[model samples]
Structure formats: structure tokens, C-alpha cells
Target: MNTHPLRWDALVFGVLFALVLVGWALLTYDLASVDGLAVAGLVTLIVAGLAGIALTLRRTS
Candidate 1:
């Protein structure tokens, strides 16, 4: 049996990264001011993507 973190981590990271874009678009609305929820969601998306990238690049050897 073989265990490698790379096998599943990449796919999951990619999905999360894609979801961030979708969340950003959906959260935006035309109005006088954007809601706090939208802003917070955007921030969360960015952090998640960056963290995912870092995790993926970590040495697996």
C-alpha cells in the first residue's frame, strides 16, 4: 500500500480555488454599498486560496 498526500490534495485545492471566483461573483450586487457578508466572503476566499497554495507547495518528500 502507498500513501501520498499529493494525490488528493491537488484536486481539492483546485476545486477550492475555483469556488473562490464563483463566490466573489455571486456575492457582488449592484447597489449603493456592498454588504458586510460579501466583503467578508471575498476576504475569506482570498485567504483560503493562498493557504491552499502554500499547503500544496509544501515538501512532500
Candidate 2:
């Protein structure tokens, strides 16, 4: 039997994944006119998006 505490539920992960997908879409289509700060934000978003994906995969496996 497994015994552990549940922190975030599936809905949370699902939302994170969905939001990251949206960020990726925005980065892809709107990167031409972004400033330096916007570039940094996009990079951070990419890293965070990867983290979200990895966490979701880890939770599943």
C-alpha cells in the first residue's frame, strides 16, 4: 500500500501544462517585436514550462 501526502492534484498539473502550452504559442508567434525584458520572460517561461512537463511526467510514473 502507498502512504503519502497529496499536495497538488491532477487539475493543478493540468492547468500548469495548459498554461505553458499557451506561453509556447505566444513565444512562437510573437517573438519578433519583443524587448530584452520580454526575451527574458520568454526564457523563464520556457524553463518553467519544461519543469511543469517534467513534474507531470514524474507524478504519472
Candidate 3:
């Protein structure tokens, strides 16, 4: 029986989604420039990739 309630994977994914939503809102409201949003998106992708790799490794080990 599993006793833990908190799901780390879901939490990480939710955080990433929230970041995308925030960036989109900023762009839509003209609070951020397109270039800035692009950079932020790139950074987010990198972070997500790293997180995925780490999670995979953790699961395997």
C-alpha cells in the first residue's frame, strides 16, 4: 500500500504549466516584449528537459 499523498511529478508539471501561463499573460497584456518571452520560453524548455531527465534517472535508480 502506498502511504505518500503528495505527487512530486504532478507538482513539477503544474509549476511548469503555471510558468507558461504567466508568460503568456504577460505577453498578452504587453507587459513583456516578444524577445523576452522567447528567452523565457527557451529557459523553461531547458529546465523542463532537465527535470524530465532527472526524474527518469531517479525512477531507474
Winning model by TM-score: 3
Q: Write the per-residue lDDT of candidate 1 for residues 32-59, one digit (tens) a residue.
A: 2347546766887799789868888895
Residue-wise lDDT of candidate 2 within 1-61, one digit each (tens)?
9997866677667866776676677668874444744676688779878998999999999
The lDDT, on a scale of 0 to 1, for candidate 2 is 0.72
Q: Pick the candidate with the highest lDDT.
A: 3
* Candidates' C-alpha lDDT: 0.69, 0.72, 0.89
Could you tell me which 10 consecutive residues in candidate 3 have the lowest summed lDDT?
12-21
lDDT of 3 by residue, 1-61 (tens): 8798999889988987898899889989999998998998898789878988999999999
Q: Give the per-residue Cα lDDT of candidate 1 at 46.
A: 90
Positional deviation of residue 56's Cα in model 3 after best superposition, in angstroms: 0.6
Candidate 3 residues lying further than 4 Å off, grouped into runs, are 1-20
**TM-scores, each model vs. reference:** 0.41, 0.44, 0.60
Cα deviation of 50 in candidate 1 (Å)? 0.4
